[model samples]
Target: MAFREMFSKNHRTTDAAPPASTETGRDDTSFYDLKHKIHGRLIEETNLAALDSMDPAEIKTEVGGVVEYFLQEEQALLNEEEKRQLIVEVLNELMGLGPIEPFLKDPTISDILCNTYKDIFVERFGLLEKTSARFIDNAHLMNIIDRIISRVGRRIDESSPMVDARLPDGSRVNAIIPPLAIDGPILSIRRFAVNPLKMQDLVNYRTLTPQIAEFLAGCVKAKLNIMISGGTGAGKTTLLNILSGFIPANERIVTIEDSAELQMQQPHVVRLETRPASIEGTGTVTQRDLVRNSLRMRPDRIIIGEVRGAESFDMLQAMNTGHEGSLTTIHANTPRDSLTRLESMILMTGTNLPESAMRFMLSSALDLIIQSTRLTDGTRKVTAISEVVGMEGEVITLQDIFVFEKKGVDKDGKVLGRFMATGIRPKFADRLELAGIEVPEDLFSIDRYYE
Candidate 1:
């Protein structure tokens, strides 16, 4: 049951969903106005400073008592059930992110997008659906946005209209307000699983087969540097997390990101997050700085959340300088594009290295590129796993070890695809053998396909 419904026993939790809104109907508008009046009075009468020190139940009880007193005094036309729900809504507005708290608790929702005060959209099971939830006004939405960014020591205002932040649970949050936003305010939340997903979960979701999972685990154990390439919302981080799980517990690992998103399960992990510049236009830390710093920390593995800027050069140096087994994700459509993006980032460092040198560095540094894609049917799948086969003349060669071949969609619009081995044993298999990790012969057999 929702927090509001649980407040009163008389209010039965029914299958019927309430108007997915704050102030659409006349009753809703009146209730909203009443809520604001009570909210203002509570802010004045209640001890706001003591709220943080008290237990959630205690705060609810204290505030609920006050709300009850005011409800009788105001003589609002509401039933007992409605009165109880009002208190819960008030608590949510005061203590939580207002209308979006319930959505945050839902595991099935992968994304929460707020275009404005009146438009709230959430992605459930990879499909976008509009919710009736809304804020009182643009100011209300901006207040919630401020609460989110301020916790992370991030500032979002006229001088800095865009800010990237995270919730307490590590969900990625981005808020862009006026001037740049054009609209009143925009908030996008990319939710993470409370319990980190395991390899079995990926297999269960058909993101990859058991064989593919085993091969990836072996690659990680073998200390082969892997790159996850995908577009936005393509499950790159999730795949990166699963791959990182294969790293042995004894090794020291360091994670660097614009925001700390990788949920590394290792005991010996050092997390470093980048910082935005202050209003004075100073005190900013970039991913390149963290990547260079992680090198001195003696990390057996350096897992970058994403290689977006000049950090790619330092990353390649780390990879070539015996810091193997590193992992990262890049926003790209295919394996070739990932290489091009990496090349471009290297050029951004003002390194006078020629094209051939860059290609050689890339071919030697990255061992594997796992391409993840969200199909038209909203199903995410590992589209291809390509191995960097070193340079052939001026060009770097790549060979696919595994690929997902798409057929046609089913009647229900479910994507039809089969994971297949390319019958080519990746050169990394030698690295696995060197590390004493066994690679099953059937794993690379073309006939051994996963339907």
Candidate 2:
């Protein structure tokens, strides 16, 4: 018998109702078999090579016709809605991200994590939950991974085994397979928001108070070098993007990242991304290389996505050498940890300077450290905003201008806290005034609390 005829015969034989105990198991197996068969038939019967040359709309129309013909010829038992859903899924498998396309389209889903072909999860509103999405098998999952990385001129195979890539819409994707990913092909996608959040949106989200936002805007406008510190997924990049909006449109800005995710609204912005080595293990571009190159570009401000290594030294140098208003992020739990992390990253540069000299350079180069935190309640908040006062003795002194004090957790598991001004005015206030920016004195009044 032909392929379609044989498939239909087997499907019909298994279509008979089974005993109660085995009914659910049989049904699941039958569905997987049917889906697999249909997917195979679509691949075999359709002229995918020709479809590739067509526009997206044309390809969808052509693929829909093929699916309709197959459904009719196979005489499959499915309702209209079921058949329509099947066509969409088949099209997704053909031209778009197969199983996770729905999650990518979902605005509320912030992350899509595929642990294996059979296991998948998504994060919505800061909480992770398992999703029904899955690949047919390991081979199926590998095909999708290849498709994603290849689009960005990158690859993942036994030779490399790991890669980072971006979707057409700028969503970040990381994949590891085989020897590196013993479980199976592992993929993690950090979806970029279709609608990027603004400073006012963050204020409404209670990430920070309006007063804190205002102060940050003033600091940015006054050209103070600011460093944002937080743990992973603590909203550091989001806050950096917001602060970047404060830069005047007239001044030029340079942004550097391993993957370009920052969305700057300023017109005079130049974005740079680091290049990984080619398959032959040549042509690698490091972040430190980009930072040193950015200085010669005459940038009014330089924004590093996150300084994780030797680039930290160049970033501090940029700030000390007249590149004011530079914004960057680092992975650390607190403001103090952020400073320590910077010192360690600078040390990674193999500089022979003593720790004291590094501390002095950090204190002089960075004027503010905005600390973000992800609380137990799944809400992100700016826990502390400190001014990097000049060195006192051998230690780098910092004065907290605003802090989030935790009172308790509510019955609903929500964090109960208030953002309060510590009463100690920032030394940069005079600098802000000198730059023709005026912030109300009461904005920093002692014991002032915002609930």
Candidate with the greatest lDDT versus the true structure: 1
RMSD of 2: 5.2
Clashing pairs in 2: none
Q: What's the residue-level lDDT of 95 in candidate 2?
A: 74
Q: Report the lDDT tens digits of candidate 1 across residue range 215-246.
A: 88989999999999999999999999989999
Candidate no. 1 TM-score: 0.92
Segments of candidate 1 deviating more than 4 angstroms: 1-29
Worst 10 residues of 2 by lDDT: 1-10
Consecutive 10-residue window with the lowest summed lDDT within model 1: 1-10
Tens digit of per-residue lDDT, candidate 2, span 1-451: 2222223222333434332332243344454555666678767654456764577776666666655655544555566787677777887887788989999999989889999899899988877899877888999899999999888889888999989899987888999998989989999998888888899998998999988998899999999999999997788988998899989999999999998899889889999999999888999999999999999999999999999999999999889999999999999998999998888888778899998989999999999999999988778999999999999899999999999999999899999989999999898899999989877879888858998
Model 1, CA-based lDDT: 0.88
